[model samples]
Structures are given as structure tokens and as C-alpha cells.
Target: MRVSQTNLAGDLLLNLEKQGAGPLHERVKRALRLAIREGRVEVGTVLPPSRQLAADLGCSRWAVTEAYGQLVAEGYLEARSGSATRVRWSNAPDTDVARPSARQAPAARFDLAPGLPDLRAFPRRRWADAVRAQVTQAEFTELGYPPAGGHLRLRRLLAEYLGRSRGVSTTAQDVTVCTSVTDGVRRMCHILRAQGITAVGCEEPGWTRLRQVIHAAGLEPVPIRMDHGGLRIDDLAGRPGLRAVLTAPAHQFPLGTVLVPERRAALLDWARGVDGVVLEDDYDAEFRYDRRPVAAVQGMDPSRVVLFKSLSKTLSPALGIGWVVAPPRWTRQLHQTDQVVAQPSTVDQLAFAALLESGTYDRHLRACRQRYRQRRDTLVQALADQLPGAPISGIAAGLHLILELPATVDTAAVVAAAAARSLRVADLAAYHATDARAAHGLVLGYGNLADSGLQEAVRHLRGAIEGSS
Candidate 1:
């Protein structure tokens, strides 16, 4: 009983040490205080003696003594010279020791989210084979901490993969792997801000996540409006002080408009004139249903554009794999960002490389492109048949299309009505950064729904929109 008691206290102290930095005494004090406040150290629970705790932590006995004394002064723990110390405070909430898990969003019978894929079609067996190959073939040296950039072979393969598939011009040396497009955006913002960039312009009806990245990096996000030709380059002329801009030039999110050729050239010229940079988010460019998607803008000027592509949409987000093909000037900084903060997961990096090397990754993509094309076609036909005169747009070359509703339609009301009927849908108003450019519409994602399921969802959706309008 005595031995088990001492070991319990020792284990707690050791776990606490790993949490933060400071003098040993201060960390010990903070950890114990939190434990008591949170009721982990329940009131009247006996604590280990200072000498035992010091030996457990490999710290001087005085450090433990000081920590206990400080807590005693704060009335968190009580110590009687002849008796063991006990927790004296109990300010914790009256509830379970662990809080209930976060509430999940209500699951809709028919989910039409823009960010999802046909999860049922994920290449599980191919992925398992890749993982097995990695374990059997990997060297002992590969087990250690991953490289600052990532697994070198994986970066090389991804560089080649992007060139073949997306026409992104780059050598293996220019690629830096990240967990997702969001991760790449954050690192780019940090590096650019470090280089004295004060602000960046993003497409107005752009992704909300991109705006969050800008805010997190302490750089201001200026919402640049878009039109039929895509983001207005002329509007950027007024903000000459802006140092960078982010675009999805191949196919803009939600609206699904491609950046026209003239604007693409002018936007590049603007970046060059201001000595600025462009971050191209090539998110779902892989699953263009109608035609072969346009090549990335990074090919136009590798020195000026940083292209971000991720497997989250193409393969599975569970893999958490992505890369940023940066200009030469920013390559070293982007690589160092992962090294300094959080390193990439080596196992995921390795499996992705194995998939690429064996041609399984490309094969999976070809299969997915076909499957997604069928889904897109099914969605278009279902809408045209069941929900006629819906005014569909953006079906030219993306996984999902947009439906522009009349200005009188209450987009939010339509979304609520759909949700009430157990159908998931999105309002375009939520995508806008500022009220100035907010449009009333629905950004319906169809790459995941099945034949009958999609037909049923659209019929319900049409009723919802009509009822709300």
C-alpha cells in the first residue's frame, strides 16, 4: 500500500514536469495548484513528502519544499508537521471528473457539405499496402525524428506528382510538406510577416479559413471582390501598400469562377510591381468533372507564386498530407517553419511516398476523378429533373457547382428549412468576409451523394427553397 501510494504521487509529478518551462519549483507549484483547483487532487487527499517528490523529479529537496510552502500559503494544500500534506481547497465544479465530449453537429440524413468527398470510395486497401511496405522496407535511421522539411523522398515524389498532374513547375528542392492547406497558409503568413509584410488581399467571397490564417499571423486581410473574370486586379491598385495576396486562380471556391487569362497576367504584374507574393490555394483542382482543369498559375512565374495543394480533397483528409511549392526566396523559410514549431508526421509522409512510388496514388486519383464525374453528372441531372429552373452555374470544371438564388430568397431561411428536414446545406452569405460582397446563393457539394440519395435530397431542397422564398 505504501509503495503504491508513493508511486502514484511520483507519476503525477513526472507528468507535470513535461508540460511547461521554468524553475523546477515554479512548474511543480503550478501543476499542483491546477490539480487541486480542478479536483484531481481532491480535498484531504494526502500528498507525498517533499524528499520523495524531489527524488522522483530529480530536483533538489528545497525545490519541492518551496513549492509545497507556496501552495500552503495560498491555502491550496495543508501541511501539519507531524502529518502528511493534504489538499485544503475545493473550488471545482460539481460535475463528472472529465467534461462531456464536445457536442457534434446534428447529423443530417442528406449531407451536402462543400468540403466532403465520397468517403465510401476511399482506397483503404491501397493505403494499408503502402503502410505495410513502409514498415517492412524502412531503414532504422528513418525511425528517428523526421527531417525539418519532411521525409526527403516523399517531398521528391510529391514534386514530381504535382508537375505531372497540376503542371506546377518545380524541382524536389523547392517543396515543403505540410499537414493541410490551412497549415501551409499559416506558415506562409508567418514567414511573410517576418519579412515585413503588413497586409494581404484575399478574394472577398473567399474561404473563411484563409481569413482566420491571416488574422492568426497578425497580418490584416483585405477582402478583394470578385466578378465573372475572378478577383479584381484593378481594385488591388488602390492598395499599393499591400505586400501579398492569396488566390484560387484555377477555380475559385464557392463561386467556382476561373481567373481569366488577362486578369491572371495583370495580377502577376501587380505582384511584381509591388515586390509582392501570391499564395495559390489549389484545393479541389484535382476533381474537375467536365474538362481537364486549368494548369496552376505557379507555372507562369515560379519565382512569384507559392502553390499549396493537399490530399485532403483528392485522397483523404485523414492522411493529413499537403505541400507548398514555394519560390526560391521563400523555400528555406517555409522549411524552417515546420522545424521551429511542429514537425510533419513521418509515418503519414512515408505512406504517401510509397503510394506515389508504386503509382497507387495516381491510380486512385484517376478512379476518383471518374467516380466524382459521375456524381457531378448525377447531381446536375437530378436538379434539372426534380428542381427545374434552379439557375445552376459553376459546373464547368469542379467537384461541386453553385446555384445563384434570387435576391429575394432568404438563403439562411432556406438552409434552416433544409436542416429541419434532416438535409444539410450551406448559405453563401457565410463565405463572405465582408457584408459589401455578400451574395444570396447555395454552395452545394455533390461529390459524396449516391444516385438515389442525391435525387431524394434535391427534391427536398427544392421544396425548402421554394417554401422559404
Candidate 2:
């Protein structure tokens, strides 16, 4: 290990100061011993030359030599004829080797769970180039902690990109950068709670994590029934106290139904009628396979809707970046609360902004859409050949599709059997907020599954399903 010579000298000097009423050599020896025992000087760390260390510590060379000699004798240091004195002792136990986990279930070989994207398709080279460029060219101020809301450059680019791409009407001033969709939702729940909104309406069968976030935020999550058209606006009738609602308008999760245009207008009208907010989760709107992506509902009325988007699906979750386009009222409070919160590093934000400005992000999305569409088709074909009569939906957009099993089939048993075969899948009933009987199927995600092994994976999944049934 390469230890900093200057830091080593400083540590020894400090340790020497702590030693009381002792001879110079003994004090030096005590200091070195203490430094070694406390791991301040880790094993394999090459120390500064005795003469240089003596000069730095303002001590005689003999004292330093004597201390080194003593540490060597005590097995705390190593001294070779041609080598400088180095630490050789360690108090820490060896933990470099990995041990197997005791979990009873077999490790997943193929992941069919929803919400995961084609991780292998991430633009690593382009992202690395952007990161390197941003880091080298960044200003001193830009390298410091980011603003509470987010880095200004990323916010500006996101506002422009969203407007041009998704028809989202927003400005940098209205965007609040967040870590993820869950973070954005949690932040909104707090804002909504502060505004006297005690409850929020969510889709009947929705993403479970966001519902948990809303509940944890001390706000009631009312499940609004959904039909094929998407969330039934009529379900909002009885909940007079529900001032806010979260919906993935472009592609509702689990069901994968796009909110029809009429319902979109009606939903906005409902929000306006109650003087409430529409928490629009622009989920999987980026990876549509059939036609051009649907314009964001926030475009209809920005004043009444708050739009949330994240790079977790488009790029990778490892980046932990998302944004919120809020109405002016909520925007003001989010800005105030976020002043005390710091976002992702300015370097990451600027790099992502650079990725967008350079058109690399868009190009990456196009490639992903093509790749995911092909993968989806392969999975669909395999399912058709194996499970002939099974109904699948939500295939027009996003990385996953719904495989509706027969009413006689046990969804839970299918999931368990899939797991036994090292094929990870989720039960559709788990995503429902209230009615588990409403839907029974598998949310199959093909994004990250390897193309070469996909056919075999599906064969195994088919066997699992048939066996379970």
C-alpha cells in the first residue's frame, strides 16, 4: 500500500505529542507502536525515509532510527537492507474471500421480474467518456456539493429534452432533481401532506414501492379501480378528500394499458375540479415499440400536474437520478425543502447533461428500444409456441409484458415453481393495492435476459407453469 509520506510524518508527530515524560527514543517508539496498533499505519505501508521523517518531526535521526529498529524487533515493522521501513502488523482479520450465503432458494439464473431494464444494454463507453470529460473540464465550484434541487445544467437540459421529446411543458426553474422515482414520490407526499391533503389515489394494481412510500409518508393511498382504458376517473367520485393521485399515464405498470386521450383530459379536469394535483409517473414512456411515444399528460395542464421521470430504466439504476416537474405552488415548497438537501454529485449531473446535449442519450434510447422490442418478440413467440392459449398484454411499450394465466392456475404456485428452476418471476396479485383477485398473471421482463439463453429460459418457464397448473 502507498501511504502518504506527509500524512505519516504528521500522524507520528501527533502521536509523539501524546506520549508523556519519556526519553526521545522511547517516546518515538511508543508513538510508532501506537500508530501501528491503531491501524493509522496499515500493514504493507512504506514509511518515509528515517532522515526525511526526522527532518519533518524536528527530531534527531538517531531517535527515528532507534524507534524503527524497536518496531522491527517487535514485529510491527519490516526493515530490509535495501528497503525503507514499512508497517507489517495488522489488527484487522482477513476478510478478502467471499463465502456462500445460507439462503435455501437457488440463485436466480433468469430474471423475469418487471421494473428491470436490459442492464447489458447500458451505454458504458459513452457514459464513461462523458464522465471523464465533465470531471476534467468542470469548474472548481461545479465540483463542490450540488444545489438542493440539483445541478443547474442537468435541470436545464432535462427541461428541454422533456419538452421536445415528451411534450412536457417545463423550465429549469420548475424541475427538482431527485435520486429516483420513489424519492420524487416521497417528496411529493410530504408536500401534499403539508398542503392539507390527507389521502392520495393510486391505481388499483400499481407499483407496490410507491404505495409503500405514500403510506410511510403518513398519507392514505386510496386504490382507484382501473379498467382497460386505465384508471377509472369515475372511481375518484367518492374520495372527496383525495386531493392528489399518482398514475403512470403513458403505460400503467402491471397492466401496461395507456391512458386513453379522453380519459387523460377527464383526469386533468377531475384534478382541476378538486383543486388537486396529478402526480404523473412518466413510466416506461421512453421504450415504446409500436408507434411514436404518447405525449406526456402534463403537457395538457402543467399548472395542475407534477411530472416525474428517472434514468433508472433508460440508463441504469446505479446512477440514481430522476427529476420532477412541479406546478409553481409545489415547486416553491420543494425548492425550499431541497435547499437543505443535496443532490447527486455535480460531476454526475453535468456528465448526464452532457450525454443529453450531445444527443448520446437519445441515440442510446433508440438502440434500447430496438433491442428490447426484439427481445420482447422472441419471448412472445416462445410463449405462443409453448403456452398457446395464454393471453399476454402490455407489449406495445416498455421492457415487460403481462402473461395472464388461466383462472384455474395458481399464480403463486407458478411463481414458486419458476423460482425453483432459477427463473425469477413475480405474481401479478402482489402489485394490487386492494383486490388480489382482480388480476392473476406473470409480469415478464425480457430486458436483461441473454438472447442466446432466452429460448431455453422460456422452455423452463413453460415447464414450471404447466407443472404448477
Candidate 3:
């Protein structure tokens, strides 16, 4: 029997005629499954309300409900109460087949992935000692839900640490603990949205996943351009209704250019003129290879900039701890938001605080910084030896360097070739917006790679590029 198709509310409508069907409910279910299988209802696409769909299809709501129930049970659709049902992608084979049990895989080796510090170097013994002391001395109530902002001891320690190291002047009251930098940005976005601001500027060729998070928060991600010296402040000027600007000024992500003095001043001037908030992400600010690290922008204008830093790059990403120092005006709002969302783990915070108090953390930072500097130098030398004339940026700071390639070399193809060779590398173009005219390159992370592995990885990368070309 021929079925009539109808366009309803920009969604594809399926019309199935009764044709010797045993049950109407089964027929409806079959039709919906066919539609989904045929790619009519795309994955993650929301379907019309069940009631609305039932009414349009001349069937009782129960029929539509049952069909939706079957689809959900089969993993073809996801039904969240009070939320519209969405088509779920089921193309990927059962992940368990390829994913080894965390126990089965040996400990991670040669982690060339950026944003990870030396886990082996973490002071586990010191942390254990601190945990023992804290638990022994603490009252039973100390184990209760922590203050939404953070433990006062940890906050105070973080304030002093940031103030001394990064030159960010903030009190314990101005500091709020967050799960990570992304969490802080999300909370900040909510606060800004409540204040009637819906758009924020993100650096182009910046942290790709963080930009996605801003968009996921229902805010516009205005891609601001970036050059060798960090974000292009000129591109941000005169942009209307821009509520906030998220930046990694200390050591710019993907392209590790320190925000120059002139640009930093210009950025502050622009933020003050537009009444915009600047989020200073001091990501990997502690591991400068050659010179002293640049002081955070938040240090220059405490009122206008919110400073964020995490131990993820300094110690380990598993240590889900980061601190944010906001202006006095935002402190209360951020604290309230933190309370609404559960606060970070108290044990981890106390352990971190103990690490800082014992001076062990600083010692580790010094040793790791020296090791990473050596590794960075070795990687740069290897790159120069293997891929001579390749423009290398972001060598001064951070664990990674950007190896810019000729426009003729397709970065996507190179990445595919690298993957085939069991070499993992990030494509620089993936960080930019579709319309952005940014240079294509690879972000080579040398922090986790041993000296030997670093040389081998560079050789593989060179081979990948050649094969791709």
C-alpha cells in the first residue's frame, strides 16, 4: 500500500496505510523503525511530541507511546522525561568489543597527548601521609559535604600560591574551587547569561573542546583570531554585546605564544572599554622552557579578568582540581553557582593543600619543568633535523609545539596516515572555525614522551607527512 508523506513542523512525517496488518501498534512501530533506519530521522534529531505525533497519525497516544517505548528499549531512541525523544546513533558496534577492561590494558605508556603532566612524578607518598594526618585529626563532621565554594584552607592556600607564582592578587573569598577550567567557564557562562549576556569570544585555533562547551551552554562562540603573539585584540574591538572573552594568555593553547606586553595592554583596554570580562586560563604557565613565565593578565586588572589554573598540567589530569579567582563582584555569584552544583571532592582538595603546604609541590614543579624543558628542546631538535624548514611555533612554553605545514599539505590526510602508523597527533585545522583562515599544522606534545620515544615519534610524523603528500 502506498503511504502519504506529510511535512509537519520541519520534521519528516511518515504516513503508513493499513494493509492487512495484524496489529496497528506493530505497524506503527515498524514504520518508525523504517524511517529511522532510512536516515529520515537523523541521530540526535528530536522527534515531535508523542501526543502531537499520535494526533496527526490518527492513532491513540498509546500507540505512539508504545512505539517510542520499543525504540528506546532497542536503543534506537533516547527518551528523557520532560524532554523530547531523540534518535540515537547505533552505528558503532558494541564498544566493549574493542575497549579493553581498564585492568587488562597495562599502564599508559608514551603519552604524547598534551595537557597531561608526569603522573609517575606525583608525590603519592607525601599525599598519603597528608591524607593520614588530616583524617586522624579531623572531626567526624569534616567528612560531610564540603562547602560549595571549597574548603577554606585549600582556598586560602590557592590564593596565596597563585598570588606568589602568577602574580594574581586574590583573597580566599575571591577564589572558588571548580572541577576544572571547563566547569568554571560553564558556571561563568550561566552567571553571564543571567545578567543578559549570551555571547562570548573564544580564540581561533584555540581549545576546540572548550569552544564546543561554550556553544553547548547555549551561548554564541565568536571565534576571535590568534597570531603568534596570542589572541588578536584588534579583531575583538567594536564587537557589540560581547559579554565575555575566554583566553589562555599565559601559554596559549595549541599555539604557545605568550600574550605580549603590548597585546595584553590592548586586551585590557578593549575589555575595559567594552565592559567585557576576560577569562585568563593560565594553562601550562608553570613549564616555560627558556625564560621566566609571563605573569597572568588577571594580575594586571583583577576587576576585569577571571584567572583560572589547574594542576592537571603540573601534576596529573586525574587530579580533577582547578581554582578560579574572580573579581569581588563575581565572587558571590560563582560561589552560589558552585553550591548549586556539588562542590569538588574535599579529600583531593586537602591533599593538594597539604602538597602545597609541604613545599613538595613546588619541588616537583621545578624538577618537572627542567625535565620538560629538556624534552622540549630534544623534540625541537628532532623536528629541525627531520622536517627542516617546517615553521615551529609555541616552543617557548607549554609541553607542545605547533609544526606549521605548507598549505599544499592536507592536515586531515596527514592525520589519517599517522593513525595508520599507530601515531597519534592533533590536526591544527580542527581547532579553527570553518571560515577561519588559520595555518594548518600538528600540535606535537613532548611532555609525556621519553627522549627515545620523542625522537621516534618525530620520525614517524615525518614519514606520515611524506606518505600523505
Candidate 4:
């Protein structure tokens, strides 16, 4: 039952010598554990037999046997008298748990519903290199718990990058790193609550999750309706005690309308009049295919607007790294209040800083812009060819677009039909706070949808609409 050296690639490649000062058996265990944790060895992979591994490591048979025995007891490996010792645990988190019914929906085959980027294009190697570089070069003290406001180096780089790219005028001192837009909204809600604010204005046909976040954070989300231009400023006019608003101005979510220049000015003016703060969730502003992306509202009056941007759309949500550029007053409050919040690791922050410093982030953006534009174009063309006379909007910017369906068509029925076909699509009415019976539109996303399946997906969608209608 002994496995030979040639049975495994690199002969179980354990660098026991570099595992620091320890007993031979303990060092062997450490090396195996490191390999398993790093995903260099996969779950269910059979380890070389004790004698073979011991010979490869130039260690005693007792060392290998004891290491294997310890790992087996720790639930990292499994061994039997007659069978080979194999990995029992995987590096991935345990997601198979009892959850609420609402969180247990089956995944659709073709997910066209919005709010995701092409995860297939994530720069794994480049990111890994950056992580490695930061881990090796970072100061000894930097490896500990990250600063409450995040790593200073990343904050500075983010400040400069946002100022240049999104026209957000701010210094590093004003930048407080947050986990995501959701995290930023929650934090801002708490901050506003501290300021004795009870209500916050949110777009009616906007991201539902953020509105829920606001509610969860103990703030009433006042639904302000939006049109083709953007959020209706008149809605903010007479709402007493409402001193804060969460908005995605550059490219709104679900609706995907860029706030017109006049509306932008009006929003700032409204904020100023009420001594309010505009929590700008700069969502999907990076992937505008039509023209140059709109400058952030924060740049116009940083005092009134707290800008939030993240790598979620541009890079990947898995990064869990984003930032908030607030006025000096809010920035001070944010840092002071961020005591219990879990900060992103210092290594990730520094690695992202490295990406920015080396111009890799910009290059990645350029590539994404080109790829997304093509995907958008292909999807648009497919939709046009399949469903003529169907008014399509929101295609000028962002990852998703709006398809205006016939007034007689049932949006809910269309969604059900699409789901039946294993092609997921969103009903526009779902985005609105109030009943939107008249809003018969389907929100289709081209971001994560495969380019190869564009035509086929559109065909299935057409069938869904036809069958539903």
C-alpha cells in the first residue's frame, strides 16, 4: 500500500525546511497544513505514503506517520488502515448550512439579472503577484490588525485615483476605507443617526438592498421618484428632518440613468439648503460605453456630498474593499466611529495600492471598458434582431439596460416564463418602492452574460415574452 515518489506531482512538494524551527514531525504537519490551506493540494487528494514522503523529505518514517496521524485527528485529513491518507477539508468556506427560505433560491442557468461584472475576467495572476509583493515587502508592524480607517497608503492612492478618474476632490485625510457600498451606506446611516437624523431620501426605482440596509440601520428611507434625467429634486423639497440622501448619480442602479447637469447642481443645492449630506454610491460609473463618464457630484461640493466607490464593479466584489471620501467633518466622525467595524486586511489594502501605483488598475479598466462595450453591443444587437419595435434604454452606460415591453404584457408573467426557461431576468416594477403596474419593462444585464450565448439567450427571452404576453 506504499505510494511511490512519481505517484504525486512534485512528490507532495512540502518545504518542511522553511517551516521555521520545530520538531521534525511538527514541521511536516505544518508544511502539509500550509499546502492544504493555500489550495496547492485539493480536497480528496491522496497523500504519498509515510515511507515515500519521509524518504522525499529526508526525514524519519515516524515523522511522516505522526504528521499524518495528527492531521487526521484535526479533521484536515482522513486515514484508514487499508486505504491511503487523503485530504478531508477544502479551503473554501462552508456554505451548506440551513438558511432562511428567502436566501435559498436555485441559481438560473443564464443569469441576465443585473448587478454583476464578468467574474471570468478577474486578474487572478496579477492580483496574486500584488498580494505576494505586499506580503514580502510590507513592514513588520503592517501585518497586524489594519487601521480602523484602512491602510494610509491605500487611502492616499485612492484619493489621488478618484480625483483623477471620477473628479472627486478630496485628500487622503478625507478618505475612509469601507467594505462595500452596502457597508458605506450602513456606516453613513449610523453617522446620520448620530446627527439626530431620522429619515434619509433614496431613489424610488433604485437598489432595493441598500434601501433595506438603511432601514436595518434604523433610518426611514424616503422614496424619491426618478425620471429619465435622474432623481426628482422636487421630491426633496419640503421633507422636514430629512438631512441625508443615498443616491447613485453617475449611473443609477436598475434604472441606469445618469443625473443631468442641472439635476446634479440642484441635488447639491438641496443638500446645502437642508445642511444635508449626499451619500453618493458611485455605482457602475466606470463602464460607460457611450461617452466620457460623468464627473462625481462630490467634486462640485465635497462639503455636501460623501462619495462612495468600490472595486466591486470594476474588479470583483470578492475583494470586499471600497472607500468613502467625505468632508473633513464626516471623515473625522467616520474614523472615530469605526471601532467595531471589521476593516479589510492591511495586506489587501497595500496590494491594491500597488496595483494603482503601478498603473495596472488603469490598464485593467481600459480592457474592461473595451470588453464590456462589445458585450453590450452584442446583446443589444441580439435583442433588436429578436424583438423589433421593443424600446431599449439605459444602454448608453452601466452594465444593465432597460427593455420597454408592451403595456399589455405582464412583467411578472414574463419573469416567471424566463425563469421557467432557466434564463433569469428582472421585472422593472420590482425596483420601484410603490406599485409600478404601468412600468412594463425588463431589466437585462450584459455584464456577466456570456458573449457566445447572447443570441440564444435573446431568443429564449423573446419566447418568454411572447408566451407570457
Candidate 1 clashes between residue pairs 3 or more apart in a chain or in different chains:
none
TM-scores for the candidates? 0.79, 0.80, 0.76, 0.79
* lDDT values for all models: 0.82, 0.85, 0.80, 0.85
The candidate 4 region of ten consecutive residues with least summed lDDT is 1-10
Q: For residues 1-469, could you state the per-residue lDDT of candidate 4 as single tens digits?
A: 2222333633556676678887888988898898877877777778888887877777789998999999989888888789988887775666222222455688777879898888888899999999999999999999998887889999999989998999999999889998888887788888999889899999988888998999998999999888889888988986877788888998987778889999999998998999888999998888888799999999999888998888888889989998889889877778766567787789999989999999999999899899999988888888889999999888888899999998889989999999999998999988888874335799998778888777889999999999988
Provide the lowest-lDDT 10-residue window in model 2: 1-10
Q: What is the lDDT of candidate 1?
A: 0.82
**Taking the candidates one at a time, how many backbone clashes does each contain?**
0, 0, 0, 0
The true-versus-predicted C-alpha distance at residue 43 of model 1, in Å, is 21
Candidate 1's TM-score reads: 0.79
| Lowest lDDT block of 10, candidate 3 | 92-101
Could you give candidate 3's per-residue lDDT for residues 51-108 as a string of tens digits? 8777777777898789889988987888887898877743545621233456776543
Say which prediction, candidate 1 or candidate 4, comes out ahead on lDDT. Answer: 4
Query: How would you encode candidate 2's per-residue C-alpha lDDT over 33-92 as one tens digit per residue?
Result: 887777676667778888877776678889889988988898888888997777777766
Q: List the residue pairs that clash in candidate 4.
A: none
Clashes of 3: 0
Q: What tens digits encode model 1's per-residue C-alpha lDDT throughout 327-350?
A: 878888888884555555787789
lDDT of 2 at 67: 86
Error of 2 at 232 (Å): 0.2
The full ranking of all candidates by lDDT, starting with the best, is 4, 2, 1, 3
C-alpha-based local distance difference test score of model 4: 0.85
RMSD to the true structure for each prediction, in A, is 8.8, 6.1, 11.0, 9.0
